[model samples]
Target: MTADQSVTEPVAATGAATMVDVAIVGGGLAGSLAAAVLARAGHRVTLIDKRAVYPDEFRVEKIGGPQLEMFRKLGFIRGLESVACPYDRVLNIREGKLVDVSVGQAYGLPYADLVAMARGQIPDASSLIVDEVTAISCSDDVQQLELASGRRLKARLVVLATGMAGALGYKLGIKRRVLAAGHSVSFGFTIARRDGAPFDFNALTCYGERTADGVDYLSLFPVQAGMRANLFMFRDPADPVMRDLRRDTEATLLRLLPGLRPYLGDFHVTDRVQNWVMDLSVVEGHLQDGVVLIGDAFQTNCPAAGTGVARLLVDVERLCTEYAPRWLMTEGMGKAKISEFYSDRDKIAADQQSLKMAHFRQALTSRNDIGWDVRRRLHFLRRSLTHRVDQMRPGWLAQVRSALRA
Candidate 1:
């Protein structure tokens, strides 16, 4: 995958040939959304990913909130409307005590639905090659890409949306090699019986505890009407308690779901359990010269935070909206302008993830910490202040309207 040592062949333009405005790597959620945005904006986009369609993915499900609005904007949210199971309320159980509960009957949409919608938005791409990006080279004027099937491409911009590809990015000198294998982990497991669970599917369930070592957080909610619910447990790898969670899942659930025993009574382990590690670090930097990183490649946040997909989608949407199309439409949109646009977005996407991570960590680890007490007190104060402000009833969306207008 060396820049100059590429095994590429000239790809004849299937029809009238034109250079691709943007070349995106790895057609996962991140790459797919970026391609859709650019293509719909009338930019010639070539997207390459190695995977077979709808490959077996580990991220089983997720909760939806303000992010649904983002899905709507991307035009990928429609298909999910039917398959997405609705469970809006969140319950927080801490160290054998029910501490906080948000019962809003909110909805939960699966990752499958989200991806389906994003893919649906752009029905076709200039060259949606089902190949991997074997090589990438970029400079002030043009971006070069080498495909696994030996195709060479030139574009105004090349985006390295490949997930956690350190070797690839480092070889291109796009980023200094850094070990980001973090200790924060989220493991998903399933139980056999769920129909009679003492709890209703209308509310989501979460349990958290902060030990002397670190944090442990669990999320439980129904995925579909007849199908069983899923249990997502997140723990810091550095914490000793997490080492044995897989062996002690039943006991852990027993402790957390005592009230739901009536519903869980008939369930026995009938499915093979599966889990994957989560990284908690953000990309050190977002861009350099010819290449840019998006999605998990940029900021691999804690999954419990569930902001990875949302932030990634927003990044592509904003970039395609404010930058990509205009670049292709004009004759002189060059490296200087592209560089500035990418630099600004890189900082913003990374910072937004940092802020969200802070709130998530504070909430999920406060059970046995003095800092948690501070977090709760401050959160309550903020809520109180917000309530008072709402009483004033400013009908004006102007504060934001003016910024958007500007």
Candidate 2:
């Protein structure tokens, strides 16, 4: 059915359940995007979220690399560009010295704005139901959802894109398997120069000086408000340093990342220091009938690895563009059909790569063993040397690297 023909129109008079092809629980990035894609594809889609307007929440505030490609493929590139602050270069440094320069396209913005843009993609207003999902019942033929508003929805398939909020899934007997508890801590805040002058660099990334410090890196990029700073570390959340970072943010930051002082040049935190302690996890007992999980609803990623957006995009693209349409075309939304998406090669790879990168970043940041020490040094050296070579002969290094890949 067309998006203009909302299931709500039919069910309001009868006070019966709205029958939809897909009932997406959560209007976050994954759910909103899925609803848009499915609705535009002429499927009857109902997107339910507790919030009509996504609040300003700290999340993956910057996106680049393969994520841009996915947005382009999903026809949201222009929309993303409209709401984001774009930059094409990044200054990479280590211990107050330039390690290399990363030249690529990236966008930075508040996570709420990103979700808002995604929600705006939906064709019809009625597709979004600003209500909470209190209970869910699933089976092979159809799935039922009971909203806190007393409205009910029945769908051929349910896409649980509720993100890291796992309570709803827990009710369905789905449990998260915590691979690493208290895995990483991330801090997000806005920063600006004291003199109110624009910073010299387009974007900047400063690596940790000492392994024991447990700092992974500090990434500074442009957003609509000002420069956004994301600090990722593999450290104890209860440490006094965490308190200092929140209380005495500017001083504590410079103390931890000394090299940053020179680049920042007397900056201050322009907003509250928002911090999060993330656990590395993936869901267990989720291979059930009638429903499938996507995005953080499926697995969590370390912020330092910068793989969260990539993994979620893989889930949305694979499930919406491929499996969901196919599943809806067939007989029933059974466990057999749901398993197809879980077993998808690209989805599996993205999920696995997110976990792999998470471990890699933790080890590279905190491990002081001789093996890791040597590897870490070599890693920076290889990047520094490659940058120098590329600077000496701009196109030469790229050509050699391309040939090696071939």
lDDT of 2 at 354: 93
Candidate 2 lDDT by residue in tens digits, 1-406? 0112223232342368889999999888889989998998899999988777888888979989879999999989999999999999999999999999998899999999999998898899888887778889999999989876667889999999988889899999999999999999999999999999999999999999999899999999999999999999999999999999999999999999999988999899999899999999999999999999999999999999999999888898999899999988879989999999999999999999999999999999999999999999999999999999999989898898799999
lDDT value for model 2: 0.91
- State in Å the error of residue 264, model 1: 4.4
Reference-based lDDT, each prediction: 0.59, 0.91
Clashes of 1: 4
Candidate 2 Cα deviation (angstroms), residue 33: 1.3
TM-score of each: 0.75, 0.96
Per-residue alpha-carbon lDDT of candidate 1 for residues 257-282, written as tens digits (9 for 90 to 100):
45445434655543444556765555
The CA lDDT at 333 in model 1 is: 42
